[model samples]
Target: MAYARRLWEGYRELLASEEAYDPFLLLEAVEEWPVFVRALRRAASKNPAEALRLAKEVWREEVPLRVLGVRLPATKEAFLAQVGLA
Candidate 1:
């Protein structure tokens, strides 16, 4: 999707911010998150509606959600590719 080259790196940079978040929150965010949900939807069934549900569920409203300054289709894996993580 051609997100900015830095978006992937910036996503990785989030690892450094681990200390800022509550560990429980991070765990819940990951397990019950829309991100993972969409990922599962794409992997297991590929249902568009289920995928959309996951996207909305995981959407972080309290925290400003950004698209890595890249395009929406630009996922973490794709972003990593830009930085050679792939």
Candidate 2:
């Protein structure tokens, strides 16, 4: 699985527990927000604080460093060489 997907799955799992999810605030959150996309549900089983922090992180507004994970093809010259075009 992709690292991002794994991270997100972990975040979801962590938030399911009472020790992590803020029922009060969670209920108030807008489901349509983009913040939901950044969530991660992973944490050490014994660390509730970190779990809550991760949840809050998913709730907050922050610019992401990555929007997509892609492996681009080689440069034009490399492609041409491979195809005998050079």
Candidate 3:
């Protein structure tokens, strides 16, 4: 545990030294959000059911919720609304 903690601290220091990278981008949710948005947008026109499925899958996952510190349904709905699919 100590070794892992030290490594994490070192990583944080390195990340802090770099101004271009937002550390939050390391989170799965933040990193994948844009891609998901684009995918959902494209899917919405061609396959609404598939887009809905993807949204539900993302909603059920814990990573985005943990990173965003938000709960289900509301968070999922907001994202869908942002893309104009809901």
Candidate 4:
């Protein structure tokens, strides 16, 4: 979990610092971590729009409740509404 947190922080930092960073560069760093790689691929398989909404929530430091699991909004507008930004 600590490693994952560090990776997430590094990812955000890289995005903030680079105008045109290559995601593949990050991928190479985690190639040996199959569990992390699998989870990443699973998230990547999700609908892009919904994924973006969830990402927006995280980026805004408003991560959704995780009592059972995350319940992603069906649309961007719904996400905004849930976050009280609509």
TM-score of each: 0.27, 0.23, 0.49, 0.30
Model 4, stretches more than 4 Å misplaced?
Answer: 22-86
Better of 1 and 3 by lDDT: 3
Task: Residues 5-80, candidate 2: write the lDDT tens digits.
Answer: 4554544454454464555434433231233333322232334455445434433312221112111124534422
| Sliding window of 10 residues with minimal summed lDDT for model 2 | 63-72
Q: Give the TM-score of candidate 1.
A: 0.27
Give lDDT for model 3: 0.52
- C-alpha-based local distance difference test score of model 4: 0.44
Instruction: Please report how far candidate 1 places residue 37 from its true position, in Å.
Output: 7.3
For candidate 1, the per-residue lDDT at 53 reads: 38
In candidate 3, clashing pairs total: 0
- Candidate 4 residue lDDT tens string, 1-86: 33434444554464455365455754543453344333433453554454344446444532322211334456756654443444
Quick one: RMSD of model 3?
12.0
- What's the CA error at residue 12 for candidate 3, in Å? 24
Better of 1 and 2 by TM-score: 1
